[model samples]
Target: MGLIAEHNCSMLLMDHVPKLLVSSIPDSQVVKNINCGRTKTAQIIKMLKIEAENELVQQLTKRKREREREREREREREREREREREKRERERETTKEEPEPAVTKKKNYEVDLAILKIIDEDSAGVSGLDMPEIFIDFNNSSSNKLLLLDEITEFSVLVVSVENDLEENILTETKVSST
Candidate 1:
């Protein structure tokens, strides 16, 4: 009789405890009086399983969003790094494009010396004695004058004409005068 009583108590606990735990009902009598079938139990289990799956899906979505944000941050860092590298490359190229200071200084020195030499020669010419004048006419042609300075006191002059008619006229005049 004691064993049968214990068995009945265990059956009562098994039937009522799960409903009480799952529904959080304060009244044990309501749980015992409720007629819960296999379909109802299965539906409750399915609802709990669906809730668990929803929570898992929400966690996975949060993790996926976090990963996407991290990827964007990494891409931004890479873009910044590339910009800095390009800036450095541009600076290097600009430095390479400029002339070196030493070479520029040498060129300026050579130009200054040439200017000074021309000034000195002009001053010497001004201080020299009187020079002779020679005339050659080229009304319809081109001509060039060259001065040969052999010494400080002696010089020679040469004139070149570019037209055949002028040369013939000069030669004929010279020949008539000489004959």
Candidate 2:
């Protein structure tokens, strides 16, 4: 195509460009650049002098090599970033191994808390899985009048049960089940 364009031969403008260049002929940027705007039997652009043409072609090849090198550099940068991320992850794992695990305070599960003045027999502290705060439900379960305090069980049925209490280690007895 370059030779044809150089000799100012007629060229047919193809929109789809089914056939770019003949295998016998070297690819030509000038012919490739032509599009639907260029018509068949049109006058081709004049080529540069031999020395100038060779110089321009060499410059174009150099620019192509530079672009390829730039792409390779960008790929290498991305690879380095990936390695840095992996290194950081490894450092985090190593620190985790060296450092002690965070102490997890055992959560007490209390269904209700009976702050009684006097018990039926001995004044023994009856603890259950339902510990104070979240699970401690204050209820008047004692048969004795000596017990005095706010009964939280009065606010409807608080649904005191062994629900979610995985461990039977703590004695969690409801008002109905309490002896």
Candidate 3:
């Protein structure tokens, strides 16, 4: 429909317009100057439309920048979470590699009980009893059996079989020098 004929354009005041227009157009005749005749009102409406479009463009630019910043923050958070997960996995692998020192005195009759205790502890891990096998080659002529406790520095991880009094080596490595 056309502009409302009943709505008096003259009734509308200049004070309602933005303060920027007040400096350019006199308050008494600002509305009348823009809407001189029926043809001029159309021009005034077009100017207002251009100003609204500019405002919308600025608002859209601001929204786009905010969205970009939010996406960057989310990406940073995801990267940190991945790093934390990797660190945890490394720590778990290290713990598995280095066997906790067992200070049990050598016993003959209680060997089965000791083996059972070790197996029970192993069951708590994710791999459970899945470990490597190792055998003591007593007959190996190259094996140095007379090395002192301090000189014989080696760390080995083994899994004890619950069914039998036997241990399977998971890993073997030379320990760090005590000196």
Candidate 4:
């Protein structure tokens, strides 16, 4: 019998080898099949097993990479949330601080008296001829004796009235301290 050198060989595991010498080529006539020569069939089987293992390893690696990426994204989102919460807390704390009020006051005093009596009451032992400008300081807390140099001014006016007018224009000049 002549061996067909161009034929492909493969192995088929069996419980029993055929006792009779059948045709050398398989019924399928494929390059690799279950009924090929022993040596070539063993090599094909090894190659198939290695390929299956390689495919499984590649699938597992892909799944791991996807899971790691998702975990990284989750960590980044958590950090951002923490930062936002801190910013909000800082803003609320700043808003809770009380604002300062302006520190100033104003008072108005009205005086209608003779200028010489005011000078006599305010200035003592200072002759009227030597008086230029006199200022008075009072130590008493009496309301009747309380005196203020500000809120005082002199104005001269002539009366003029319109028919059925119930309003009067009164003008006074005063030195007032204000903020």
lDDT of each: 0.42, 0.42, 0.45, 0.43
Look at candidate 3 and tell me the lDDT of residue 149: 22
lDDT of 4 by residue, 80-136 (tens): 999999999999888877565864332333222212113323334655533322222
User: What global local distance difference test value does model 3 have?
Assistant: 0.45
Name the regions of candidate 2 deviating beyond 4 angstroms: 1-48, 99-179
Enumerate residue pairs that collide in model 2. 109-129, 109-130, 109-131, 110-130, 110-131, 110-135, 111-130, 112-137
Instruction: Judge candidate 3 at residue 36 and give its lDDT.
Output: 39
Q: What is the lDDT of residue 59 in candidate 1?
A: 75
Q: Tens-digit lDDT track for model 3 on 80-166?
A: 999999999999999999988985432111122222122222233655454222222223335524321212222433233222235
Q: Model 2, 1-179: lDDT tens per residue?
A: 43333322223422122232222234454443333344432333223233345666887999999999999999999999999999999999999889687754322222323332212212135555232232322334544223233333222224333323565424354441112
lDDT of 3 at 83: 100
Predictions ranked by TM-score, top down?
3, 1, 4, 2
- Number of backbone-clashing residue pairs for each candidate, in the order shown: 0, 8, 0, 1
Candidate 1: worst-modelled 10 consecutive residues by lDDT:
105-114
Q: For model 2, what is the alpha-carbon lDDT of residue 157? A: 28
- Minimum summed lDDT over a 10-residue window in model 4 is located at 13-22
Q: By how many angstroms RMSD does model 4 differ from the true structure? A: 19.4
lDDT of 2 at 52: 45
